[model samples]
Target: MNKKRLSEVIPLWKADKRNYVKKSTFSTYVLLVENHLLPYFGENYDVQEMDVQNFVLEKLENGLSQKTVKDILIVLKMILKFGAKNKWITYESFDIQYPTSRKSHQIEVLSRTHQKKVMSYIQEHFTFRNLGVYICLCSGMRIGEICALTWEDIDTDNGIINIRKTIQRIYVIEDGERKTELLIDTPKTKNSIREIPMSRDLLRMLKPFKKIVNPAFYVLTNDSKPTEPRTYRSYYKNLMRFLEIPDIKFHGLRHSFATRCIESKCDYKTVSVLLGHSNISTTLNLYVHPNLEQKKKAIDQMFKALK
Candidate 1:
């Protein structure tokens, strides 16, 4: 069977995305095609709306997670977009409504006390193995950004860590055990590349571990092999266990670092820069939301000021 022409054209489109889009984004596009798409679409030489709609409806009826369905839909739309570009499929706004209901889960940041406790636990139980976790807790570096850190990127003398590249998970593959490809690439956006001022505490903590020369490309690695995010996370879980703390996602550290900075009266812009946020507005919206806690504080502070 001569594979559909779209199969041939898809690679070209992905190559375009890689060159024009961020590495993380390109990785996402590629995964959608490889895992969810190619498996099903490989048989469909010519894609049709009725076929796509039936597939989507079936996925919904089968009770797929909203997130999974959303991902599938996104890839489908992108593929249709590719087809339209090549005149294989006529372009039009989607006709049928997509299954919608599940709102994105809210990320609850650590309260001041909880954040402090977590930090204190990390500090007290700190080991060389978890030095990277400790640094991220204090510095608000994203997991990808920190994992991409190179020995040359850290400047102890200047008390700074240069933010250049990030390590992002692109896809899960089967090579016996489920595996994910980690691509070390540039930050999410131009603003994601910024110099973050390192705290003296972190600088001093890292001083001993700092290698004078690292032949391996990455600063964070084991046995000269680049460490995968999953293994790095296993160590974090062990650290939390040792400290008798509740297990939280690695991203919570980002929230904790941001909250601590706010509590310490670090300017929002500085915190934003420290986090390497592409936009200050995004930092405020996500990390600096004016929730019930802040609302109460605002009213209380206003009354106090009047008094």
Candidate 2:
């Protein structure tokens, strides 16, 4: 039997896998292999469970999130399985355990006053570009989805915004060359392709211009050329600073929208569908956190029922 290095088998596996997955997915696998797997295990054809377990610990120590490390391991396992199937190496199944995480990520949201302030300010002083931020606040559109939207996707008559595509800049490495390119593709999942009703305020703001702007022009730029996510994010940062609002990620707008919906007692399934999450559990887990008031109310209701 011919001995095969892990490095030698990776390219072959990538070539096979490339045809079967989305470009974004393939790019992620390649990135994980080059940055994580190759550096750690490329020279070793005799990969073992202990080596992988140690790699997981090392990655955790290096400050990579558990999810990210698991993603890397998934790619590594795929390559190993491919090599094993072809008789290039032996494959061993392994389980990776993470220490109990003490700190949970807090979902950042705008205070109701802050949210109202932003909406009022934008309405009083509006720009075509500034409207994107308002849309995100009113509807839970993601940065990429909002950036990709063209005027044609907006239906003034029905007051709906069709979320059909998303724009992102993806890292590509080919023939030993690295480059980043803009990719306009369908949203992250089939669930993400959805329609959101425009608020009355949004419709009023957008209606007049909708008659004048070319349908093919992007909503963000009102031109054929669309602003990318990075540029839009910078614009959002400026808006936040100008409004004297505390610093939060652009994604926080989406979180604020979803949190507001859950607070208003919108059904979880409807919130999930509106947010384009693939499942209701994700919406519940992220935004349905109960306050002390709600917990106490629940306890009171239980006592009343018992009586």
Q: What's the TM for model 1?
A: 0.74
lDDT by residue (tens digit), candidate 1, 209-236: 5655563456666335566677777877
What TM-score does candidate 2 get on C-alpha atoms? 0.97
Model 2 Cα lDDT, one tens digit per residue, 75-181: 98899999999989888898777888999779889999999999999999888788999999999999999999999999999999999999999889999898998
- Evaluated against the true structure, the overall lDDT of model 2 is 0.93
Error of 2 at 119 (Å): 0.9
State which candidate has the highest TM-score. 2
Q: Model 2 clash pairs? A: none
| Structure candidate 1, residue pairs in collision | none
How far residue 167's Cα lies from its native spot in candidate 2, in Å, is 0.7
Off by over 4 Å in 2: none
